[model samples]
Target: MKSPLVVLTGLVICCISIPILTSVVSYSNIKQETQTKKNTSSQSSKLEKNEIIKKVINYETVNKETPIINVYNHKLGKVQSMNMEKYLYGVLAGEMSAKFDIEALKAQAVAARTYVSYKQGHKNPSQHKNAVVCTDFKHCQEYKSYEELEKVNGSKWIKNSYSKIKQAVDATKGQIITYNNEPILPLYFSTSSGKTENSEEVFSIKYPYLKSVDSPYDKISPKYTSALKISNKQFVEYLNKSYGDIKLTENNLKNQVKITQLSKGGAVETMKVGNKEIKGTDVRRIFNLNSANFEIDFENSGIDFIVKGYGHGVGMSQWGAEGMAQEGYKYYEILSHYYSQTEIKDTY
Candidate 1:
């Protein structure tokens, strides 16, 4: 009925209105769905986080009273009696937290127990003997009695040795450590090979027997050399084998060996053996080749050797500890001297 222009305008208005209404409804629905999803996701995530925290918080409390039993070797009998605390103390004592696992702790407990029992009465199980009450090796120099040794060495030597033995017995709980389950006795070596002119030649009495050698430092045998020589390429191979797979290059050689990460309360380090990247704990086990008590042949060296020191190089060097103790260092001070980034806590 209206003019052609008016009819066209009315049609255009209707078309635009329909589309605008549809778009507004679709957007409202989409916004509601998105908000619902976000709320659900946030709640789920919060629940997961709370569960993880709860588990962590309950771990110590749950395991605190767990009964720890003594693990024994059938050959040696009951090695040692311990609960968690005592076992933990033993691992810490050896600076072995990096390699510490339940199995390792059990092994250490056995060793500690066996050592303690052997020290207590294994020397002469049938007979009870009084503890060795002397000051130093010098005092035990074929002297008839403590009085005689004291007279010869003087009051200082007597006091030092007595104090040393007391401290040693107390620290080890009167346990006699066996190199390979045999009693570790004082081993003596002549600083100068083939009987010396000096009556009191420099003697090393503790573990990892350090002997004075006449050979030039460079000419020193590879066994005695501490520097591990490996080319850049070889180091890469070593790392792959020892640590599975890792990012390594000639550039990493600058750091050499270093603790890269810690896992399950253990230290993980990047170490190069030959020319490879190996990741694991560093345990230094030292062996002595110069003890006269145990004979060795340079040509065909085959001896049932008994050695000491649990992990790499030399540890708290017992002789070194004794020296520090003599100089009035306490037990804690002696422990701190050898280990870094460690705190002393009561085992009990």
Candidate 2:
């Protein structure tokens, strides 16, 4: 027979062991959570640090090797090859106004360089036969030759503007924005309605770095506010085509033409024109409007459109960048503000 004392002692030991085991498990879980949080924080810190480095990178130290870039000139009817820097001179002169701040010009240079790099990496045979990219924005970019530049900016303003553009291109020689060590599509537009849109929202393709960010300077752009007027009959006719047969009277357009949906960035995602629905881009295309972010109003004689900004409202806004630079922000600052989760790196 076992002693009562011995049995009681054994039970006490079991009780103690149970609590100890529970405490050990709880401690292990706590430790694991702490480690996970630490790892996440460390990762975030690295990303921020990388961005800071990019913001401060010396433009003069960038690689100066003048690479040969093949350009398909639409006017020339043949592939023309020239120094990459020379190509930039024309692109910068065409893309943005030279009257902008120097920092803004530099930002444009980086954007143009990154855009070219992305195109180079994803070379499409269908795009060009003997050229890397073309002189048209539809094919590649808007390349303004010296003569075209003189024509657009005029003989008087061309000299000063051209020099500023050249300075920007020379300063940021071979820099490109990269994400995960790969060239990224540095899409820039004319203006925005205060904020940019995520790539998925505008294009249906989710790009990590192309997420929406607020651009306070966008509203300051000269083209920020524009009005377009059209007859109600024209508006309804376009809607009928989009709807594939919808009966919409002129009265319906005045009473019911409204925005049905909006993207997170405040751009019109879908709008109701009478009984039919259409995308914002469709409205812009049909009427040759300034931007997708617009409001429709019914006037007694015609339909009036109050547009907030210009372009597709995705990626960088050139005027927005210029405004930012004018407000004392640097070139890298403008780039970082527009493109989220991206780093500017030297192409060398």
Candidate 3:
């Protein structure tokens, strides 16, 4: 979790045959740029209509014991423990936007809570001791404090967005998805590639609740399409940077990139970069592309990668959940649609 300060390191790359770096700025001052501040609109939205009635929630009071989560701040190298419900406010704020449907937010709240619940004992090796999770995108869920939300979300939507996230967390207090009375890890991502992939395909682990399923609604996601173009020179540079043995000449550049395999969800499973076979995940990381579900186009000027969907195609799709919520699906129904054979359990 980066504190309230946002930083950026900038290099002005000149558009020439050979790469030219004109200006370099300090990483700490990168956030001081005008455009960087403009990127802070937290797109956090509508609660779906529900037939289930609201009841007295909060397992803390019901069980006569408050549940607390030890969160390790990766940047600060400190541990902070708070009531589980309070932690979710930051999770929901950090994970999903405020503009999402209220039901979708609630669904995210449940999934995030369940994920932490299942990962309580299996802690990340952060600097702090007894830390259940770290505020890192790769290790654990992203977390944004209320104060951070205020700065990033701005003054206009800050109050309302916080209110919506808080309501979702409060409404689903102490509720988690379980299978056979055991808490299940409810993994979720930004969006899917028209369908969600099975757990085995992505992580090579089998979970009964994680299965491939049609998520046609994901097609309507805002991030459904992304296009990036790499010049011939730039493409060669990136390839040589990663795989020093890459030998793609100007004539063979068009045919150098090949799709070796495809995942069940139609995402690139493995791709051949010249002589090296690399995972699509690696390619996505190398280019900072939105997702692995992409297609490459060779043109006279450069090569273009048109990506579909976003994030890892596994578990629940956030935008898919929002689409379902917009179509009048309840929170639990949306959860069941994504998590397969799972039960919604109330610990209280």
Candidate 4:
């Protein structure tokens, strides 16, 4: 009874309905897959961030434990494994006067510890291949064992000084001077010439933290001003020793050997020794002057060098630290004053 047109319309409806149902199923599957991918990507990102945070925490805690170090004892000619704190005690004794204020000793301890830490982190120095540091003051920091201290300073000194030194070391257990969250090269000397020398002025490399700063307290140092008298023949010979052809004379020495330039820190930068130019540092080593900040006074018989300060005139001044401590400054304050733009952090 049905017509042929009605039958064709029914077939068309059936085909269209089948395709619509299949499309709906496909859309549902695609939506589920996309959601799953989004969830996975979010988890992966969180994991990546967590891993980065973990790495930073690990680096910060790397030196959380005390480290035993190998020291090349110049006298024994052998490597000695010693506790880090004990080593610091020896360094404090040798590098600084035990009679210094407690705060000054603490500052020296931190400086010494930071210096050794910096050295150990870098490649082993060529001078001491098997050791992290050496006892030779010329190469590394000076060190003296308890026995050596007893021999040099007497038993009474060892008894009184040892406890004081230990208190300083223990009070500041693992503290070190750092710049940019890294250990710094804590170069200290006996005294300064009114102000510390900028790193570039004294050495080839310039450090941001090692800038010239006034050290008014350095005058309190015993070695603040010293005069060395050298005969004319001796002075001329000393100049010629390094330069080979310096034409300096005993008479009119000031005219011939003139200080051509002075550093910002007030040290001689360059001096004209007759026709030859020489560095102030070379002059210091040649004449064994206390520091490069010296004036040459020509006399009838000899030359007088009126020198100010001692050592290299760079970084922390030992006597200056004591002076600051005497002025009621804390160890950290003393350190901050000398090492500009630096922080004290616990390395262990």
Estimate candidate 2's alpha-carbon lDDT, on a 0 to 1 scale. Answer: 0.84
Error of 1 at 74 (Å): 30
Model 3 C-alpha lDDT per residue in residues 1-348, reported as the tens digit of each score: 654333222222224412422233444466566545554432110112132334213333344354887888886778888888888898899999889999999999999989888886455565346888778868789988877877877877776778889999888888889887788878899888898887776777988998888888887788988899988878787877888887776565668888999888888889887778988888888888998888999987688999988988888999999999898777888988998888887765
Q: Model 4: per-residue lDDT, tens digit, 1-348?
A: 899999999999999999999999999999999999999999999998897665331112335567799999989989999999999889888888889999999999999999888887885657787788999888889998988898988988978998899888877878889999888899999988899899898897899999899999999899999999989888888878877777777777778888999888899989888998889999999999999999888888888999999988789999999999998778888999999999888878
TM-score of each: 0.26, 0.80, 0.77, 0.80
Cα displacement (angstroms), candidate 1, residue 264, comes to 19
**Which candidate, 3 or 4, would have the higher lDDT against the true structure?**
4
**Clashes found in each candidate (C-alpha, N, C closer than 3 A):** 18, 0, 11, 0
Sorted by TM-score (best first), the order is 4, 2, 3, 1
Estimate, for each residue in 65-147, the C-alpha lDDT of model 1 and write its tens digit.
42353433222333344443343243223322212222222223323333333344334423322322111223211112344
lDDT of each: 0.35, 0.84, 0.80, 0.88
Mark the regions of model 1 whose C-alpha exceeds 4 Å error after superposition.
57-227, 230-348
Best candidate (score: lDDT): 4
Displacement of residue 132 (Cα, Å) in model 1 is 18
Error of 2 at 7 (Å): 99
Q: What local lDDT does model 1 show for residue 217?
A: 18
By summed lDDT, the worst window of 10 consecutive residues in model 1 runs over 190-199
Error of 2 at 64 (Å): 4.9
Each prediction's RMSD over C-alphas, in Å, is 21.1, 12.8, 25.6, 17.2
Which structure is stronger by lDDT: 2 or 4? Answer: 4
